[model samples]
Target: MIDPRRLRVLRALAEHGTVTAAARALYMSPSAASQQLAALEAEAGHALLERRGRTVRLTATGAVLAGHAARIAAQLEQAEADLAACSAGLAGEVTIAAFATAITEVVAPALPALRARAPEVRVRVKDAEGPASHRLLADGEVDVAVAVEHPGPLGVGDEQVLLHEPLYAEPFDVVLPQGHRLRADARVDLGALRDDPWITPWPGNPVHDVMVRACEEAGFRPRVACLSDDFRAVCALVAAGTGVSLVPRSALRGGLLGSASGGVVVRSVGGRRPTRRVFTAVRRGSQSHPLLRLALDGLRAQAASLAG
Candidate 1:
């Protein structure tokens, strides 16, 4: 009989494409993960992994087993959910992953309400970006994830193991230094800032992609003077008269910009304003669990409050 835990490790290895990455995601050391996979191979009586130069790939048999592992994992999740439903009480722990801004504006505000509504249910929060959070949720390391929709298809391998619950649409705003010419405008036009130095997120960041696309639509590329992933740092740079940046309105509301000195102003972006859809995701099988449902309700309430 195959150990379900070993099957899970194999599934993680399949999903992550590397022993080190899978081990980190599973919160295990590389040696332990290797041992588990080796034990799994012994049980299956076939090799599951082929090591290349500095990487590992699934063998033919490994791929087949991975498919079975995914189904078994999903079935196990369903069983757990069914058992939780039998109890019909919000008494278990629910882990959530979210980005920084959402942690402050959505999850933090929802915590008090969740505690009040279901004192027996414990909540754990992990701060991560949308893609990373979704990866954690997919790997079953997290019960739910709060994430933003990017400009493409969702999830690696297109498995659709997670179901989304839309929360709110967050619009981007332009952050400008005080006394800058653009700060005088109620809504800043992206084209107007084409010649100005820009402060934006690093390359490949979702927000950076949004900024780039917004500028492209305006018919020019931004002259990025500085790059930082931290919204607060972006705001601080803007406050210190370094360069302007685009940030989600949610970040401003969450005190990212407010914490910066008074040398910056936020304005709406003119012409087809860019926005990201913020949503919560849970494994399809576990969405109906009492604890998950209660926690989702708390999140929905907080999102509604933010929208209002």
Candidate 2:
């Protein structure tokens, strides 16, 4: 009988054009690839490859086989995905890749409600910025993603919008160590901290880029004291007096504050505005998932409470 593994080998050889390259991609040695291809030919009872100079070319039979193999490969993948999605007893995982602020301020609150509704559903998180999350969604690596839009500059990519929540009307105040000298002021001016080292998110994310620009607009370059995309960690560091940070106003409202405290104060900067806009994204057709819809409904309800 023609084995699917052999058919896969045949497909790979056709796609890559050489046993050497195909073997490397398949993580097999060239000799192994050749052996497998020969075995496949024997099983199929036909010539699948032909010599063209030092290279090989697919015969007409090979082309016909490759076509069938492609369909077979797709069906196999889809079958596996469906089985995983359906077998878990309210369990199947729904992975979410989100930008820093949304996960910290928005999604964090709803996790408990999600688990309560479908205790079997395993929710996983990834750090994917707004534009990049679309690629992950398209590729099927993540089932949901919470992305951000920075007011006028963001393009929504090809992502389907699920929920949009205005978490903070403006960007957060720069958190200072508790009992820091500036806490006494009504709102410390950005000019004072211009020379201070700042704790901010890493690059390739919106928050990092926004804070950097917020500082430059304040007329002085900021010294980034620590870098991370984790919201809780950022707060912990600030509480530890590691360095100051810019945080969303919503940070003041959640468990994100934790027990960590350093008598941190918050203040505003001048020039470029500090607030950011955020959006929730999922695959264009993914709302069909029962849990995905429930999750979004819970999110919107909680957001309305927050907004009020």
Q: Whose TM-score is greatest here?
A: 1
lDDT of each: 0.85, 0.68
Instruction: Give Cα distance to truth, residue 69, candidate 2, Å.
Output: 20
lDDT of 2 by residue, 1-308 (tens): 98888776776676566888767757789899889888988989999899777778789998788767756655665565455557544556777777655666567777898889888777888877756675565434677766666433332223122234443344567788885667777666677787666889887667777777777777777888899777668877887777788886666665556666444565664444487666566544455456666666666655555452
Off by over 4 Å in 2: 1-94, 99-105, 111-132, 150-170, 236-242, 268-273, 287-291
Worst 10 residues of 2 by lDDT: 154-163
Clashes of 1: 0
Residue 78 in candidate 2 has what lDDT?
53
lDDT of 1 by residue, 1-308 (tens): 99989998888887788899889989999999999999999999999999888778999999889888877777788888889889855687989999888889989889988998888888999998858888888877799899887776555443536788798887899999997997779998889998888998887567888899899999999899999988989999998888888999888874566568487988998889988778888876777777888888888988887663
Q: How many clashes show up per model?
A: 0, 10
Error of 1 at 287 (Å): 1.1
- Pairs with backbone N, CA or C atoms under 3 Å apart (clashes), candidate 2: 91-120, 171-275, 172-247, 176-264, 177-263, 177-264, 178-262, 178-263, 178-264, 179-263
